[model samples]
Structure formats: C-alpha cells, structure tokens
Target: MKILHVVDMISQQRGGGSAKVPYQLGEAQARLGHKVTIYASDFHAEDQLPPKGVELKKFHCALNLLGGVRITPSMVFADFSQFDIVHLHNYRTLVNIIAANKGRPYIVQALGSCLPINGLTIPLHNFIWRNLILKRASALIAIAEMEIGQYVAEGADSKRISLIPAGIKCNEFNRRPARVKDGKKRVLFLGRFHEDKSPVLLAKAIKILNRNDVILLMAGYDDGCEKTMRRQIKELGIEDKVDYIGARYGKDKADTYAMADIYIMPSRREVFGLTLLEALACGTPVIATDRCGVASLLPPECGLVVPFDEYALAKAINEALDKDIASSYREYRIKWAKQYDWSKIAPKIIEVYRKVLGT
Candidate 1:
C-alpha cells in the first residue's frame, strides 16, 4: 500500500510528541514492505529527511504576506490524490485544512494539540475536521481514549475512530543488566523544559520531600524556562539538590535512564509520553501523573500514579524510595514494556494500511 504521512516537521528534536509517533510508525510500516512517503517541513537542516526506506518530501512552513499575518499554506488547495491513505500528523496548519478537502482517504492522528489549550482553534479546527475531513475519512486514529472521546464529542464517527496507543522500539529502551549502580535515589525528569512539562513542580516536589540523599536530575533544554525553574528551586532552597544537564538524547538518554532509580514526569497533560515507555523499558520504575496517558501502563506492582499535586508526587517518591523495590519493579517494568514494543504494534498498523487500501 502507498501511504503518505503529512506532518509539520520531522526532526526528533522539535520536542513534539506527535512528530515522534508518525515517524516511528511510518518507518516501521516502510520496513514491513509498505511504500511510505513523509511530507514534512524543512525547519532545520538536520530534519530535512527521514531515515532510509521512507521517501521524505520537503515543504516550506514559512510565512506568507497576507496583510502581514503569518499563516501556513492551505492544504485544502493542494493535490493529495496520489496515495491510498493520507495520514495527517501535526499538520494542523492551514495547509492541512486545504489538503483535508482533497479527495482522498484521510486519517488524523491527534498528538496532543486538540486539547483546551488551543481555545477557539478547537472549534474552528473541528469544524474543518468534521465537516470537511472526518465526514469523509476512512478512519481516524486517536493515541488515547480521552482523545477518542474528544473526537466523538466533535461529531466524529465512533466506528471510524481507533484508540491506538503509540508504540516504542523496545530495543531502544531495553534493560541493561550491568549499568545499575547503588547510590542516592535519583529522580530523573527527561523532557522538554516547557510550562506543560511543569519541571518546576517536580523541583518543588523534591524541595518539599526534603530528602538530602535524593538527587534530582533535570535533563533537557530549558528553552529560556530554566531561569524560572531555577528561581523556584532557589525559593524552595533546594538548589544544591538539583542538577541541570541540558539536552541529552539517544545514548546519553539511555545512560541517564540507566543510572536513575526513579523516572518522574510531572506533566499536566500528556497524550502518550514516549519517555515514560523508555524509562519502563530501561527497568526504571516511574512516578507519573494521573493525567498522563502513559500512567495507564503502570500497574500498581510496577510503579505509582498520583495527581499533579506536589505533595502527592513527593509522597509517591518517598514511598518508592523507602520500599527498595527496584529489582522486583525493574523486572515488572521490562516485562510490561516489552508488550508495547513497535515490533508487535507495527503489525497492527500494517493491517490498518491494508484494510484502508483494501490491498
């Protein structure tokens, strides 16, 4: 089957969860003998193309002068009839809206943009999605059931909507037996340093816990929010307890996970966090928020799930540290993460492609 995956950008570093999902799925599908072509923006030279087996098409996501307002190209005005399935990623720009109206079998994978944060854009995007795309779509894939509910509320056909959780490459996050070290309980927060990530909350939780032996490793680019987080740490008087290692990915990410005793994600909202899976696959127990879709993967035996409150998070952290259940929980984490491996999940996507194209 010929599949066209449309997204705004394809760089792994753009720090958008949506970009990772489609790229992972597209690559896996291509590996499985499907013809996959990705349409992404050339924002960074490093993000110009995808890996082998998938053809990457470049497009400019720059601004056009329409009375000095920055706007994306209209998708409703593009030609999109070449593929059997048009899977739109984070291409929620004007170009996608134009392309959606094109006569093709459409499927939208909502990463996390459809939440209330978009305000009036939700209604407007929905109007175009429902009346223009969803009404004519072959299917719509929602990463979480919560997202599926949102799509249904916007009048999307329930039959056409599938709650398909994003799959991680298990080998990329597999347990390393030799790297475990016994030391102070380390709480790691490895993600974008954004307001939604709520890095300050994790810092505040560490401050409240007041565990001198517990260290906080905040790894990722601050993107200018580091100063605010530093102020919070200073106000809480835990500056000495936190270490900021800016922006580590790939092997550095794996090594950090290898050393950590616990993985913490205090995100206020997460559709499905890939890092959560990465942590679990590394045999590291997690203490994630109830709002995170990744928390669904956490059984009581594996880790703790708490509300976004600092006290609640701190309490969970203490409980995890005090129990010394690392070995047992690590075993459970590895077993649990293996079930969601892309090696297993990719087949379902291939089946979806075949079903959509009737090949």
Candidate 2:
C-alpha cells in the first residue's frame, strides 16, 4: 500500500507528538513492505531526519495564524491522489483542509485536538470539520477511549472511530540510566512550557509541597509561558527547588526519564500522555491528572490520578516519592511498554488500512 501521512510540522520541538506519530508509524509501516510518504510543512526541516523507510515531503509554510494553524499556500496545488491511503496527524490545519478539499478519502487521528478548544479558531474549525473533514474521513482514530467521545462531539461517526494508542520506540529506552545521586530526589516534567500544559500549576504545586528532599526538574521547549512560570517561581520562592532544563530528546530524553525518581504530566488536559508511558516504561514513578486520557489505560498500582488542583498534585507527588504507590507498576514497566511498541501497534493499523481499502 502507498500511504501518505500529513502533519503540520516535522520536528519534535516544533510539532511535539504530532510529528513523531507519523514518522514512527510510517517507518513501521514501511518495514511491513508498504510505501509511505509523510507530508508536512517546513517548520524545522533542516534539523529533522525521518526514520529510514519513510519519505518526507515538506512544503514551505508562509504564514502562521497562531496556535499551529499555518498557511502552506503551496500545499493547495500539491497532489495527494497517488496514495492508496491518507493519514492526517492533526485537526483544523491547512493540510487537513486540503486533504478534505481534494475529495480523497482520508483517515484522521486528531492527536488529541478533537476537543473544541484553541480559541477563535473553534467556530471556524467546527464549521470546516463538520461540513467537510468529518464527512470525508473514512475513519477516525482515538488514542484513548476518552478520545472516542471527542470524535463524536466533533461530529465523527461512531462506527468509523477506532481506538488506537500511539506507538513507542522501546529500544531507545532500553539503556537504564544511572542517576547522579544528589541529596535530593528529582521529579521530571517533559513537555512544552505552555499554558495549556500548566507549567505554572506544577510550579505552584512544588511551592505548596515545600519539600526539601524532592526537586522538580522542568525540561521542555518554551511555548510562551516560561516568563510567567519563571515569575511565579520567583514569587513563590521555590527557585532553588526547581531546575529548568531546556528540552530533552533522543537518548537524553530516555536518560531524563530513567534518572528521575518520579515523572509528572501536569497538563490541564492531555488526551494521550505519551510522556506518561515513557516514564512508566523507564520504571520511574508517575503521576497524572484525572483529565489525562492515558490514565485510564494504566492500572491503579501504576500511577496516581489526582485532580488538577495544585494541592492535590502536590500530595500525589509526595505519595509517589514516599509511599512508593507503584511497586507492581515498576515490576512490569519494561514488559508493558513493549506492548505498545511500533512493531506491535503498527500491525493493528495495517488491519485498519486493509479494512478501509476492502482488500
């Protein structure tokens, strides 16, 4: 099969998980002897090297209309008809709009953006999605069970929606990291320092916890909230308790997760907690909010699911380090992570593709 994967950008720092899903999935699919090409904007083209088998087609994005809705004017004239199947990595983007307008059947994996958020674009996005994208989509993929409802709310057909979790590269995290023993135990946060991710919430929670033994290692690319988070950190006087590392990727990301005593997903809303799985796979203690879609997939003995309250988050963090609430979870971390590896998960996606193609 000839597969075309579409995304807004092609780098981890620029596109986060959105860029990764396609590259990984396409690579895995290519290994199965299928031709895969990924279509994306040239956000950070020079830095990215897509995995061996996947072909990356990058078009120049001339304008950014805030919140990742960029205008790649050239993509308007580009062709997508040659592929046997098309996969869209995000919702409400020029790429998706073009795929819909092209009158070709495409599968949509919203990558957790199905919820009607992202201000100003909501109404317009709704109108376009409901009227066009949703109607034209052959299938809708849910990374978690909760995302199925999000697809329904977005006007996607229920029968067309399939639950498909994102795949992980297990081998990259196979090396166990030796933690540098300081006096303090560290809890790591790996994501963009954006308001949506609730960087300030974690800072406030760290302040509320007021612990001498635990340190919050905040690492990520800043998405405009670092200044505010830094201000609040200073105001709360928890500067010494928190360390701001820019971002971690490749082996560094694996090492960061492995070295941590605990990992946290403090996002106000996370449809699929990729970092949560990474941390769990690394055998790190973990905490997530109730709103995390991936939380449902984890067993009770694996992680703490608290509400979004700073106090509650702080309490969970305390329990994760002190009580060791996840003993059984640690025992099965590596084995469990292998279940969602691309090698296993990609075959299920191929089944979906086969069904869609009626072959």
Candidate 3:
C-alpha cells in the first residue's frame, strides 16, 4: 500500500506527540513492507524521515499569527492523486482545507481539535472542519471513545468515526522502579502552560495541600500563560515550591519522566492526554482530572481521578504520594502501560489503513 501522511507542520516545533505518531507509524508500516510518504512543512524541521520504504515531502506554509499553526497554500494542494491512501494527522489548519479541496478520498486522524471548549477559535474552525474537512473524510479517526462525542455533536456521521488511541513507544518510556520519596518528592507537569492545561490551578492546589515535602516541577514551554501562572504562584507564596523546567524533548523528556515521583496534570479539557499515557508507561503513578479521555483507560489501580476543582486535585495528589497508594498500585500501572505499546498500536493502525483504503 502506498500511503500519504498529511499534517500542518511535521516538526519538533509543534511538540513531540503529534510528530512522533506519524514518524512511528510510517516506520512501522514501512517495516511491514508498505510504502509511506509524509507531507510536512519546512517551518517544522523533520524529526525523522519515514523508514526504508517511506518518503518525505516538505512544503512551505503561511503561519497563522495568533495560533502559530501553519496554513497550506493552494500550490501545495497539487498531486493528491498519487497516493493509494491519504492519512491526515492534526492537519486542522488551512492545510486541511487545501487537502479537502483536492477532492481525494482521505482519512482524518482527529487528535483533539474538534472539541468546542478546547479553543476560542471554534467558530472559524467549525466552519473549516464542517464545511471543508469532515464532510470529505472517508473515516474520522478519534484518539479515544470519549473524544468522539464532540465530533458526533458537531454533526459528523456516526458510521464514519473510528476510535484509536495514540500509541506510545513503550521501550522509550520503559517502566522504572517506583521512586521512594526521601525528603521532597518531585512532581512533574509536562505540557504547554496554558489556562486549559491549568498549571496555575495545580500550583494553588499544592499550596493548599501545604505539602512542603513535595516540590512541583513544571515542565514544557509557557504557552502565553506564563505571566498569569507566575503571578498566581507568587500570590500563593509557592515561588520556592515550584520550579519551572521549561520545554524538554527527545531523551531529555524521557529523563525528566525518570526523575519524577508522580505525574500531575490538572487540565480542565482533554481529548486524550497523551502525556498521561507517557507518564503511566514510565512507571510513574498519575493524578489527573475527570475530563482526561485517557483517564478512562487508566488502570483503576494505577492512578486516581478527581474533578477539575483545586481541592479534589490536591487530595488526589496527596494520595498519590502516600506510601500505601504507591505500594498497592504501582504494579497495576506498569501492567496497564505494557498493554498499549506502539508495537500493538502499529498493527491496529495498519488495519484501519487497509479498511479506509478498501484493501
């Protein structure tokens, strides 16, 4: 099978997870003896090319000022008929509009953008997705079942939707021995710092818990919410308690995972918290909000789920650090993480490809 993978920008600049998915899938599909070509933007440097049987096609795109996501121009839309199947990953910008207008049968791997509450750009995005993209899709792949509801609400055809969770390369984030807290436990928040991500709320919750023995390690780039979060941290007098580690990727990201005692994500909205899966696979117990799509897949014993409230989040955090909580649940999370590796995910994705391509 010859497959063309499309997206807005396929660089590390957009962060790791989305970029990693296509690269990993391309590699796997190529290994299984299929041809794969990735279409990405030059603005986002290529992290890794498709494997032996795959190809890379780079195009130029115009950058959207506010979101920083790129738009694919009409010129890039030519030559859509070359591939057996066109698979799109996170190509929700004008790039998707171009692809849809090309009038080719395509599969949309909708990551999370279709959710209304996830962005303020909903009105315009709705127009683009409804009028331009979803209607043209042969299949709309959702990361999780919980994530499919939003698409359904948007009037997407039920039969066209398929739920497939994002795959984690387990070996990269192999299970580590549970860290026993000595003095201060290291808590990691790995994702862009934004209101939706709720880093400020996490800081406040930690302060309310008054767990001086726990040091909050905030990782990832500040996505326009640094000043607001910094102010909140300062007001709560948690300036000393919180350490911002900025953005990390590659082995640095894995090492950051290795150093943490627990993973905390207090995000208010999540289609599928890919970081949640990454942390669990690293053998770190997770504490997250009810809204996380991955939360349902969490082994009941691996972590605790709470409401998005500060108090509930704080309680879950405190519990996650408890010796009893860690001891009783550690193995369960490790076992659960082992089940959804990239190796397992690869074949499933191929099956979807075959289905969409009618092969």
Q: Largest lDDT belongs to which candidate?
A: 2
lDDT of each residue in 130-187, candidate 1, tens digit only: 6775567677787777887777776778888777778887787774743335567788
lDDT of 3 by residue, 1-359 (tens): 78778766666545456676777778777877777888776665645354456687777665655676675564464687877878888746666777767766788887777755457877886677776888778888888887678778777887988887887767778645545457778888998878889998899899988977889999987778988999989999989998888787767777787678788889887878878877777677788888888887676677878898999888878877776454455556766886677677777877877787678
Q: In model 2, which regions exceed 4 Å deviation?
A: 117-126, 324-329
Evaluate residue 171 in candidate 1 and report its C-alpha lDDT on the 0 to 100 scale.
Answer: 82
Ranking by TM-score: 2, 3, 1
Q: What is the TM-score of each candidate against the true structure?
A: 0.90, 0.95, 0.90
> What is the C-alpha local distance difference test score of candidate 3?
0.76
The deviation in Å at residue 168 for candidate 1 is 0.9
Tell me the whole-model lDDT of each prediction, alpha carbons only: 0.75, 0.83, 0.76
Model 2, residue 354: displacement in angstroms?
A: 1.2
Q: What is the C-alpha RMSD of each candidate to the true structure, in Å?
A: 3.1, 1.9, 2.8
Candidate 1 lDDT (Cα, whole model)? Answer: 0.75
